[model samples]
Target: MPSTVFDIPTWVNPKVAPDRHVQIAKALYSVPGDLIGQRLSARVDAQTVKLYFRGELIKVHPRIAAGRRQTDPADLPSELTAYAMRDLNTLQRRAESHGTHIGIYTAAVLEHPLPWTKMRQVYRLLGLVRRHGADIVDDACRRSLDAEVVDVGVIDRMLARGATGQQLTLLPPPAPSRFVRSATDFAVRRPS
Candidate 1:
């Protein structure tokens, strides 16, 4: 697949002098996980190297602009030039470490949705149960099982009882019928 070029935004300022080694280090660190099976987009200009990991902006090395103000292709820094080759080497190592020899394009095809989305929602509800159902388990036992176990049945039963109680409390009170308007009518009222 053809490589795509990303235009680096002019306003972004780099805090440190960009060294190729440091830039590579920042890039590796900025990535969320072990870079074994991921795709990276690296752009090197006169002043900086910006990396995008899995389509997300990850790191920027500002040292690329240390001596140059103009973005002349001919005046690209030697460090950046060396970094381009070095970055490729690192990418190769990452690929091999992950047991794959494919380039970034091929890796993109293999990426899957993050698992945390499902895990987080389940974790939140489980947390609620743990906080509210403290009486159900001993403190020592709760601590041991907190990270490993989920009590689905207890949560369901608690929720069911709460719903039933609410339904009963919300019921309308009984009202007297118009036909039986007064107690005197039922009592012996003189014929009128």
Candidate 2:
């Protein structure tokens, strides 16, 4: 008796279902590419599989997409270009190794936020950090002293101790990452 090996479908085949395209799109977008206008073409032969990206072809094994699972973009980082490229490579390799076709579309470049908007966000975050700094300092002090002093009490104490504006820094400074998280989290956690 002869042993038999089963062959499965490749990702690049046009025969792949339409729902698979959606799954592929979700998986591809989870990586960091712009999905605007790129096209994917796949071809499979008996021993090797090929995938073409904008006419550039690569060879691989064919069973890459068949046995594996499709991932969602929402579960990945917003910038997923590198991940997408990796997936593409895997698919191509699988195709070539197993004699199947796999086509994957290229994505469009992503647009970054405007400079002014970014600056505004940074300033906003800095403001939040400054506002929260005193509270954080007060909390630390209280914890260190094993007391329950409020931030207002700390401010009052500082004033009573004749700590001038120059001697006691009361103003908050801008911190981009801190402010962004603080502001957003503050809003979300605020009671109605």
Candidate 3:
């Protein structure tokens, strides 16, 4: 009978911050909030760490160099979504690069009174590009620009039916607001 010997590396237990994240060698790492206050282990690799909580492996990420931090959108706690949504600059740039109309539309949607609320709409519009391919989506967006349509529903319909380029009378745009509105405005005001 013959047996094979396997070498298993060891890990170290460590405490995490209230944000359920830790910094290793100047590189920040996200840990599930639920893991906070519990014994956790960090199995180090040259480029990543296998984070374990309750003896269960949770996250692995490429080692971050000094002065660098990484935050996964999925790691964001529910309560922090609004704060996270505040920065959609990357998505805006992506939408802008896709096409002029898409960029305009994405900007408008993100500018809505409650941009976070409208984020899903933006994602849906972007999903079209994924489904139809970037080139086709760009063509559709070009046609959308020609048709003077910026609404996602209209853009989607046009793409599905191949009517993007053909012009059709669009409804008069709603009166443009002179000022942008933030989520705070919708909060129920209490008379003091």
Candidate 4:
């Protein structure tokens, strides 16, 4: 009998997870952000893993050990690269570039026991800056920080309702009417 080559790569069809990664041999490999929730074919061999989408090669990564992750920052959304890499400073700097208060506000928003969990909120805040302008977002962030609120949704609501903070000045109380007695008038007078 003659010796013959019999090496073949194992093929796997995996669905890209919400995090834009696929598992091969227990190791996680990142895919493009647009591929999330889509099925992809992977060719796994001894040295590398190749991913294909719709029969077209999309990504290739060196095979890693089990319980490890191989992520390419370019494979993730630009806004999410910092989060995926747990680079909190990047987000803070991005926010600060818009405004000092915006940076402080984002830091407050991301100040959690598990800060990565709040990355999406920071992402939303930055998006708000783009949509509503940096000055507007910075104003909202300043107001929110003054109010001790750290919610992106609240800032978004402020922008949606055109809360420029200038129009929120307190108005003087209306003059008392004879018909409406003051609360003190209803109180029983105790004998001295």
Clashes of each: 4, 29, 1, 0
TM-score, candidate 4, is: 0.59
**Stretches of candidate 2 exceeding 4 Å from the true structure:** 1-37, 58-62, 65-192
How far in Å is the alpha carbon of 180 misplaced in model 2? Answer: 47
Q: CA lDDT of 1 in candidate 4?
A: 62
Tell me model 2's lDDT, rounded to 2 decimals. 0.35
Candidate 3 overall Cα lDDT vs. reference?
0.72
Instruction: Give the residue spans of candidate 1 off by over 4 A.
Output: 1-117, 133-192
- Identify the leading candidate in terms of TM-score: 4
lDDT of 4 by residue, 58-121 (tens): 9999999999999999999987787779898998899999999999998898788998888889
Candidate 2, backbone clash total: 29
lDDT of 4 at 119: 83
- Model 2 / residue 81 / CA error / Å: 8.1
Per-model lDDT: 0.40, 0.35, 0.72, 0.90
Q: Which is the winner by lDDT between candidate 2 and candidate 3?
A: 3
Clashing pairs in 1: 17-63, 18-63, 47-64, 47-65
- Model 3 residue 22 lDDT? 74
Which residue pairs show backbone clashes in model 4?
none
